[model samples]
Target: MKASAAMRTALQRQWQEGGWLSWLLFPFSLLAAAAVAAKRLAYRAGWRRAERVGVPVVVVGNLYVGGTGKTPFIVAAAHALRERGHRPGIVSRGYGAAIGPVPRVGCGTLDPAVFGDEPALIARQAGVPVAVHPRRAEAARTLLHQHPDVDVILSDDGLQHLALARDVEIVVQDERGIGNGLLLPAGPLREPASRLRGVDAVVTNRSGGRDGTLPTPPAGVRAVDMDLVIDSVWRLADGERRPLPALPAARRIAAVAGIGNPARFFATLRRAGIRLDATVGLPDHYDYAHSPFAAIEADLILVTDKDAVKCPAPDDPRVWAVSVSAHLSDPTFFDWLETRLHGRTPA
Candidate 1:
């Protein structure tokens, strides 16, 4: 069963207080924990060998199940590496998309129904080679063979992808951090907090705080601050460029978000002084085939960039996509990344 807002909030509070509810669900949590442990053990015991290709593989992912800015970070990382003269390709499981063979990305040819929203967004935003497969290793191999000039591979949300060997692992955490610090069905974490001990770096979208803040990184694990900043706003489908509307003028906007945290999107709009006359929060990567807001009237329709990828221009002229970029404040993270890339065997 899907969790309610009240249940989610209670779970978070229970985690903070170490309440009895956590204990009541401890039995199931234990099973989930055991499964994660066993999976890791299998990889460690050499029973499941991780495939390592010649090119460097950098994975940006989070321990939590919900969104933590992984897609934006991957887009930013691809841009960063490209600026430094590195050809980077992306691989994703294409979550929420129908399973299929390795798929290619191209203008008007990339199908969101087959490759998922984030992968399609990355392809459109980065304009770089992208391949999607349930098995990321397979996709990476295909990407490398198709575009042999690529020097590195950036895997979007692949912390748990044991089959694909990686040279650098960057763990991403948002304001929620590891919500309630509990496993699935009870909390938000996909794995235990201790699993973060081995990653190359830890990056937090928010700057600081305790609750709703990322934890301090362990020694040898670098910590960095990352922020998602909007660049510009554009009319939906028409692709007509326009300045972000002033708060007073945008007070009656209708906001729509098909992401892990729709509330976060709404809060951002509210902070921008946009009066949300209505807000529709659909499941993550929701397709726009049948929208609930067809009957609702509004002056403007605001959406995230990820959602815009599935809904191309002119089809929804009133829609505007809010583009965000991930900014890293720490230099050490880049220094380490450069070192790793330089050390890789020449491709």
Candidate 2:
């Protein structure tokens, strides 16, 4: 395994199943917790002002530091709003990009390498305006400047970014919930589990409920369930819609996922009855600058949509991107959100 991947595995083990390493790192987490608390306090006490971008901002964020179906959820929510006659724009912190203070803003097919994978995916899939920068508030302003009709903004995973003032906060949690429920460096939680109590809505991704029910959420918080179903597979070379069952039942099939939780992608394909000969799970937000596909030998290759954005082998006919969409248990979640959002004065 690569050194970084090995370290990530080790840390995941430590975070999920506490050990001596997690305990050894607990002190550092305490310091991080202190800093996070102080920073949030500064915002709350008016020491640091949060800038609102003259629109109703709904932050689809995370408490856990990994995948929770936030990207697909944001795309799905954007579609839902557009269907309801509300124009929505998106803003992100461009997690894996090398951008500066100035925000990169645009619509249509954007370069994931320049704008970040998730934002690019949102732009392409939602066909809505998207802007990305380290400062999400700045990105929001830029997006609004270009798309002045945007009535709402769906922020991609900025729960801790207090500077980007939001009207509604929605936390997306996967089956892992909060690993070990400790702060950064010691556990997977970016914020305390108590953070859920204050959010406007909680989205549980694939809660694994047999009867299509989710666990009880924190008191008074509206909750919904999200499951990403493999919608279809498209050719990276020609953007052909190759259905899963139709993809030649012959040949060695290998799936590659460069996502926060790759196992989920592999399992989704498996459940879709795709007989794969191999699965390559890369690190979250993995840059394809060094294409793994060059070395992966397979007659057919499948990749997650998030990874597809930054894939270097778009011309390789052997590779295809799996298109997945979020299936919400309660469709009314958007209606509930829209009502609240419309209650506020949108920019």
Candidate 3:
């Protein structure tokens, strides 16, 4: 009825076959390709300016849209910088915000509606200064002025924000990698794979057969592996935390996710052995104003940390949010990052 659940699989096969599907979409892809090329050309030719702040800026972003673990990577990077004694602050474009002009985020000071969900999540998790502006350069400047002591600026999801010059660029990729390797509408790539040639590093979030290995990089581009760690679960209403209960061990549960990868969330819940009464996958960054709460009459409502931010105070005491961390396995990854941030090995 809904086309087919194998839509993505079919698209990938079609893409690999290089047939009419690819040709039919060639014009659209070409247009997207041209726009991306022009944007990069403007930056290269100095027609577009890239603003550099006083401190080093590290950008954590993805080529594909939706959750590729960029936010978690940002948190890990900020923590890493802090451990090395480099005071780190974050800046974002504040996607989905209704208000703008360089908004500042601090403890208990930002509204998700104005600063967007990810910035608020970063501010809350990093416990460091965060700022948002449509113009990332302005956001970086505002953050630096507000917290002059911050020694490093981390730009969340700014791989394509060429206007904000960055010292380090970390492109995060999920299991989908570039996703059929086509540009928007036709597939999921926001920029061509060639664009990754210039980045400082590549971090893959999850490891699956597809999109598992890092793409061929340009000379000097480093590839690394990163994993997501679900530390524990928390009550969504008031942030009361708990360990993820042993899975397949629980019954009468409902899993909710308003993130880029809803299926992943659902799969995680299923793996935990919890018999899901229902799975509610809201659009990414959903405000939760019209979430199907009526359908969630289960004993427990499990959600991701990102979704918990927007959900109303849980009407039922059983609603919980799972908070996750990104862990990089390569020792060299941190070593390289430390060198970039501090110009020396961390003590």
Candidate with best lDDT: 2
- Global lDDT of each candidate: 0.76, 0.85, 0.76
* TM-score of decoy 2: 0.94
| lDDT (tens digit, per residue) of candidate 3 on 191-235 | 888878878788877622233434566677788777666788877
Model 1: lDDT to the true structure: 0.76
Could you give candidate 1's per-residue lDDT for residues 1-347 as a string of tens digits?
A: 12554555565567555567777877788799999999999999999999998899998899877676788888888887887888989988888787666455442236788778888888888878888887889888888888899999999888998899999899988777776778865666788999889888888875222246556788878788786766667766667765565322543578887887676777766665567888776677778776545554876788898888776445656678887677788745565686777875321
Quote each prediction's TM-score. 0.88, 0.94, 0.88
Q: Give the alpha carbon lDDT tens digit for every residue of 1-347 in model 2.
A: 46877888888878877899989989999998899889989998999999988889999899878787899999999999999999999999888888886899988899887898999999999989999988899889888888899989999999999999999999988777777878988888888887788888898888233333234688788888788887788888888896666675557889898888777788778777788898887988889878888787789899988888888886789988899899989967788888888785322
Worst 10 residues of 3 by lDDT: 207-216
Residue 218's lDDT in candidate 2: 81
| Regions of candidate 2 where Cα sits further than 4 Å from its true position | 207-216, 344-347
Candidate 2, residue 12: the lDDT equals: 84
Pitting candidate 2 against candidate 3, the one with the higher TM-score is 2
Pitting candidate 2 against candidate 3, the one with the higher lDDT is 2
